[model samples]
Target: MKKISRRDFLAASAAVGAAGVLTACGGSSSTAASTAGSAAASSAAGGKSTDYPTKGISVICPWSAGGGTDSCLRAFCEAMGKNLGVTLTVDNQTGGGGILGHQAIADANTDGYTIGMITFELATYKKLGTSELTWENYAPLCRVNTDAAAITVGAKWAADNGITDLPGFIDYCKAHPGEVQMGGSSNASVWHIAGGYLMSATGIDIQMITYQEGAATAVQNAAGGFIQGVTVSLAEARSFIESGDLICLGVMDEERNPVFPDVPTCKEQGYDITYYTQRGMAAPLGVDDAIMTRLEEACAAAIEDPDFVTFMNNNGQAISYLDAQGYADYLKQAAVDVAAAMDAVGL
Candidate 1:
């Protein structure tokens, strides 16, 4: 896959003309028009407030700039701003393993102007005792991307072991218990939980290795043959897979990702394991409902923008858009599921 620079993406987005607008019809007579205009103004004032976002909006990204989350957030924000008719600034407040930035979002004024990108880590921070932050602290706006975890192995290792698919991997793990080391993101991370879930679901034991930096480093180690396999997001392993340095055995999702449709899901391979890292937008708790509605509308339009879709597809990022209420429901279930998995795995 070709790398899409920030500059290139912005240029492409700028080239695409503004999305089409919808207009309402008005009566021909002056008296009728005046009455219609007055009714419209009254309706707008009583319903969704149209005066929101008078100034620029600030989007706090917990991760460092140029990372997957930051890059996707920037692209999404750029597109969203067009719909909102204001600039959305992304501030990278990186520290405390994403806690600082999330806290910033939670602690910011409860206005629609301040929002942030919340990641899967939100489900683990409380369980890990790192912070008291939870999904309840923020009102979810929309879910942008959900990249599923995948089981990938170095080409040489797969070739040497005669493993080509999930069943073969399970057999190999069963035959050589604790011999095949599985590397993923840091301990208690989403990737680590995914690795643990895989083992539990398949009834196989493999030594779990934790990489502090993240899945990218773990994937790099796997491609270099330091480890047998890696349970990381497919996006992180895309380059290696494209170069034939690593082979993705199975994706831990209910359905196969569009970017790698040939790779079967874990369930399709007879293993009932599914896991992914979800990224979405959220505002501080207590934000007005009208402002939330406005934000959600803008988010929906941004995710559907052709330019944004093209950028995400080229970068191997899966597009999973969810509306506000749907996102809230997902967070509730995700909290329960994450807590159970962490406790079972002793994270």
Candidate 2:
């Protein structure tokens, strides 16, 4: 097996440009075939006045299993299972930073048996002009939660560079603008967005590098002196922080994250911006509305379940529940907002 490093993965991201690659796959004819027999069987099961899920439910995770997105969905599924009365099985269709899996679920039958998790890529890839998969192509079900990014410096780098905290780091950058090198996966990725937003706000000139490797690659490179700082979600870098490999500099949220109470937010640091990337459930365009509604309700129930709440809280996730309609509205506004930002940054 190839033990791919994050640097190796992200090198390609910078080279090719991070773009959205998704499409609506399942239509009535295709989905009808996939769902007919199961629907019939389920209907018969319900004829006896039994509950839903006379069949198994498939939740497609567009990212690799065991990654941040997958782990979060797993927690939600465990809670949703109780309300859905079915075995919510997760199918990992990993590729193209989640497009393969996104397409898989998007094309699945909308007969209330198939659902999938949606992430930032749902809007970003499309903006990159890579694919036709846009928010318009998917039925927004429910947003599970929103994650605020954390700007971190590799511990050794911080020590070697003599930067102790957020204020100190800013002073260092001001003293040596453009001398500090920053690395991220690609344009429109969370890292890129965070780096760009911070740079714009601070008026600091940093050599931002983009690689295709992904967040893991960014973390490794930052630790190895390949870059000076990284703007990624705390969850992705949790392990390194625990090992004292990285120091949390600032968060891109309204306030400090409970898990890292000591860390100040961008607002507190005097940068006025909130970069909450909400991850959630979505289906391919043209999926049945009733099924979308059902999935939305299921996710809502899961978000409130104590077990799921505790699990996410333990993992440092913030609860920002949005039902199907609310999710749709958010996506619409996000598209507009991000487009404006990208244009302003000349990305």
Candidate 3:
């Protein structure tokens, strides 16, 4: 399959605001949800900034304990707790493909005592029809990190196919469209969308095998040769790559990930594609402005905490910071972009 020329990809990205676009079916998330915006604003209006965090606070996590999101959030919360002078408890409210926990965060009291780590999947909830939850449902505090997806395959498969690099792999896919199989984290997950992005960028056809259990299983399938490769992040595929069982062909990022300096970016290999899954903190809608400000400050301070910094570096997660307003703007644009990706995968 002929990969997309840089000019073609840039034009496509431009049509969708670089991030991409959701069809009008997902509605205009360009602005914060009116109800949430007005309610949060009115809640703060006529009120003096008050002292926050007189007691312990809880943080909701949509994923399972010990997972990437959970561990990172735990470290972050610990740092934030230090800044706020209060304990921050992480409640793993896992279920419904992160919908239940995300909804729980939005439905929490507006007292700023309850906040949560919202993830990349928040952009898909409404489009997937799983829940009405979206970034518009919460008052964003700040963006924490983003992990870029990668093209990693079993060493045996690459050797057998003579796929020495990303171009070689693309040539094989072009020669035998629909014969290649790639694994993904879950249906409609970011890894899944990465597959669609790959196909959209390269004009190739391949079967996407999805594992609902998550990326760990998909990574295993790739290593075991049950699939041709995986489109998950390098961190998720790190063990296999390290063991020489799998070789990463390319990362969908503008620059190389520091953890894996040798892995070339897709852009460097003639594809201008870049995609990542993000995580950030947010509170329920209608949180008082003063409390939101205090929480945002805690998030800013906590992101740079030495412990959190070490934890993220060691964990292979990249820190991509964005303040409250920037995060809100990003969420809106991400919703637009994700809609187009969902369309790409026939979601």
Candidate 4:
């Protein structure tokens, strides 16, 4: 796959900005897919916009380096910065299941320069009542990708225990309750959320191991016999899966992933729950209308760039684009969905 250089991506982003006015006309009602695609293509070729990126931008990622959030946003922010004629540097402020990064952006002046990725943590943290941070804390920029969970098992363990697939693994867990340990990246991270949902749906008592450590480390621990199961973003264990170090049991999604089409979804396996781990940017609350509009346009351009799409696809991301209001709507619905899920499990 050819990667679009940051410089070109920036150039294209600028062009798209110029087409923003045109987009407004079409934006009144969502256009057909073909029209939207054509508009996006023209915007890419249109030329740089005059009202963007007078300076560098700071994109705060809540997770550590090399994690799914970092990798996905790095590709996107780099492309977006190129489009906007600025540098988008990522600052890792990891802790408290993403509260640190959330707080950083929430506390920062809504100057449009300091934006950060907000994940399911945005909702999960609220349920935990850890801090006052919620979707309202930041300006919803655009969603780059949202991930459904993947059931990953250490390669060695799968072979040793003869649990080759999801059903077999579940059967084994049912046969030997409490023997199989499940490790989560964070207390309420999507990884653990899927495990909890699975436990409730399956009635399997898989021991939950809390490791607020990064996803890679969590997968390593699972593969190393510290635990037997892990649920994480596809990006987190992509390399391991390639090298046969891990086996994905089932992906916690409604549709099967094209790349991992062989893997079944939790629903396919008779589980009714579906949870997503999303990555998107939001500005601090109280951003000016002009700046917010510019930021939203820039983010939209970033999401539409062909290069960005290719990058996300290659990196195991499912494109889930939503503008500010759409993202806000998602948050509102998510609060209800998450609240219901939590109640179902009595969390």
TM-score of each: 0.77, 0.79, 0.80, 0.82
**Which candidate's TM-score is highest?**
4
Q: List the lowest-lDDT window of 10 residues for candidate 2.
A: 23-32
Clashing pairs in 3: 1-174, 22-336
lDDT of 1: 0.71
Residue 279 C-alpha lDDT in model 4: 73
Q: Quantify all predictions' global Cα lDDT against the true fold.
A: 0.71, 0.63, 0.73, 0.65
lDDT of 2 at 304: 95
Q: What is the C-alpha lDDT profile of model 4 across 1-347, one tens digit per residue?
A: 01111122221222111111100000010101101111111122134333444667777777777677777777787567645656677777777666777798898876667878887766666667887777777778776688776788988888988987778888988898767777656665556555665665566667666556457667777666777767676667777787888888888677887777787887787665465677777888886666677667778888888877887777777888888888788777776666555544444
lDDT of 3: 0.73
Best by lDDT: 3
C-alpha lDDT of residue 331 in model 1: 84
TM-score of 3: 0.80
Model 2 misplaced regions, further than 4 Å: 1-51, 211-213
For residues 1-347, write the lDDT of model 3, one tens digit per residue.
12112222222322222453210001000111001011111113236656577777888877665345666677888888777777788787766666777888999998888898898778888888988888889899998988777899999999997888999999999899778888765556676666767877787777777654456667777889988898877777777889999999999888898888899999999988887778889999898777888888888988998988987887677888899999899889888877775554456
Q: Write the per-residue lDDT of candidate 1 for residues 1-347, one digit (tens) a residue.
A: 11111221121221111110000000011100000011111113335556676777788877654346766787898788777777778777755557777899999888777898987777778978999999999999998987777899999999998999999999999898768888766555566556666765677777777654456667778889988878777777778899999999998778887888899998898876766677899999998777777788888999998888998988778788889999898888778766665554454
- For model 3, the superposed segments whose C-alpha errors exceed 4 Å read 1-51, 65-67, 340-345
What local lDDT score does residue 18 receive in model 4, on the 0 to 100 scale?
19
